[model samples]
Target: MRDTTADGAADTTADETADRAGLRGDCENCFGLCCVALPFARSADFAIDKPAGKACPNLGEDHRCGIHARLRQKGFTGCTVYDCFGAGQKVSQLTFGGRDRRTASREDARRMTDVFPVVRQLHELLWYLTEALTLPAARPIHGDLGRALETTEALTRLDPDDLAALDVPAHRQNVNVLLLKTSELARAGIGGRKKERRGADLMGARLKGADLRGANLRGAYLIAADLTGADLRGADLIGADLRDTDLTDADLTDALFLTQPQLNAARGSTGTRLPESVTRPVHWTPRL
Candidate 1:
């Protein structure tokens, strides 16, 4: 059974499990928008180069990945890590009223492609905003976060034309102000001199066993960095590029704003401790 609050209502403290249910990808309800709307290059992550608005050759007529079970083995690791945060279903159903791109007019299909990425960005903000409300330390700004969440949700319901014309980055900047404050309040409780490494280029750095507790690593480029055995509790990892970062035995018990896609993009071992919000990536090495 799912855990509940004292009154049997869904728990919103720390985990925000109920609030995040709709913020995750539900491909079954989607029309394969990610495979058709987004472009990807032929690299280690993808087996072939696909252009935007062009359906991936591997996408089936039923809107399912033909090679779903063997995506990694077939050199499509990027698809495994990508999550639309539930934007695909929202666009397929609510935004376009269950219209299938295969049957829709060419102009309508083009609009769907354009509107999808916009909603994806908004949904991602919803993910963070939902998380911010669950932090007890961020109670001071709960009212602001709540209002932002409501506004962002309303934006997602806009018509395709309106959604395409929406000033997303400007709104993101507004919402980010609150997230920064949330980070400050949440990290302040951790006992230590917090490190401020916002947007720092730390690519390929040797940081194994480092103490990153309460560190601000927002937008920091940690690509290919060795973070094995690091203590990252309470660290703000909002936009840290963790691609290829080694996380063997790392304790990220309370790491702030660490999303599943970021964890999936990195390398981890069975010993890596994670926060409650995300699960252990299936590709991580097992203990032998």
Candidate 2:
């Protein structure tokens, strides 16, 4: 999301710029992999149940969402918040050499489907590692993060069979170590007693206007919580569930590890102050 340092200044380093570009989804170059590879059940998110490896009814012949512009309005809110982290295009153009799934053999298509999720996971790690490298406070472990980013990027370029057989969870476990260190280093400079709410269940809690500066909210269940106007500056938010969380006017400047999908899933307002890495959610109400 952000290619800036912890101080909110943009990092224009060549590596940083390239990483930022590759980390975002470019649907035009993708072959609708997510619409077919992933399955969804009918819920508040989707209007129909779709099995894995089966194309969604809304997938077009040209490999685009038929209702791309109105996914949330059409009861496919899940799609709007779903980000493949640029895995879709990488799989379509590089892994399979731009082969169209419809025209490919059944076995090839199956392999494509099976390999997608693995690469997606790796790409997400790349995203985090890239962000970590940009943090000035995490300079102590920049070498480790750089190596991890290189290794993870190499893995993404592996053959489909190799990608499918890769031990992704093991790799993710290793990457988490560096990310944890980065979080600690970045939050250390924040002036205040930071709250430690890691993995805490704060679902639906009335925390409006709470002073949570430098809080470690990693993996915290914040679903439906009223966090309006909360001071979450410099807080670690990796793995925090923000679904339906009210972030209206919340100041999340310098928040660590907050992803776009997490922000998109929450309810915010135009008055919400966010980090440079993430944009204001289009669905957020405009301030009067």
Candidate 3:
């Protein structure tokens, strides 16, 4: 693609940076694919309404953003922060054969779009696990990380048809055990693995550095625990009341169902890592 922007030199420089670091969601190679494929509602986050697999009005047929420079003014701040962790490009080029889902057969398009999010999720796990493998603090799980990387890579390489059939959540559950151990080893230097607020009714415990790895926190009423520094690496929070647990520094990165609001509410510093699909919570504002 020719440089259409004013500073053609700047575009080439950016292309070099992107190629070296692996493509981020903002890369031009993506063809603004996510904007067109995903659904959104008319609200504070989205200025206009859109449905799944439908093209966004601001998307140009040339795979460019019509409101690229003024997305914030247009109420697309959500799109600004969205990242596919390299999965978007992979789906566009590899899984879907370098073509947009909209151009594919209806059945193929539906299947591809529906499965993209799921694979994006798995790739997300891969991203986190790959990062975790690099942490010296997680040395105890280095071997496991290597193995996990291989397994997740194998899964990522599967054909979209086969990938769509996968039970990812179940696979995630199996992977969680190893991730739990990595968390445990990393946090052990801070404290032992046990967090007990037994009957304290910690609706939202903020124990980011309070190590709870390997702790049997079963059935604990931590509906919304603010476990910021608390380490829950391998702690069995199974059946625990974590409906809205704040896991900012809690290191539930490898823990189970620690999904969404539960993952978003907690305080965490930059060192506090998590899955790719999920991002660091913007609210906590930790400096650590």
Please give the lDDT score at residue 210 for candidate 3. Answer: 73
Q: Model 1, 1-288: lDDT tens per residue?
A: 123444433234544677788889999999999999999999999989999999999999999999999999999999999999999999999999999898888989999999999999999999998888788798777777877888899999999999999999999999999999999999999997889999999999999999999999999999999999999999999999999999999999989999999999999999999988899999999755
Candidates 1 and 2 compared: the better one by lDDT is 1
lDDT of candidate 2 over 108-142, digit per residue (tens): 89998899999889988887888887788987777
List CA RMSD, all candidates: 3.4, 3.6, 10.7
Runs in model 1 lying further than 4 Å from the true structure: 1-15
lDDT of 3 by residue, 81-181 (tens): 45666767777777777766557778877766666777677766765565455445665556666666567768877887898888999888777776666
Better of 2 and 3 by TM-score: 2
Candidate 3's C-alpha runs over 4 A off are 1-20, 191-288
Model 3 TM-score (2 dp): 0.61
Weakest 10 consecutive residues of candidate 2 by summed lDDT: 1-10
Clashing pairs in 2: 2-277
Question: Could you estimate the TM-score for every candidate?
Answer: 0.94, 0.94, 0.61
Cα error of candidate 3 at position 150, Å: 1.2
Candidate 3: worst-modelled 10 consecutive residues by lDDT: 1-10
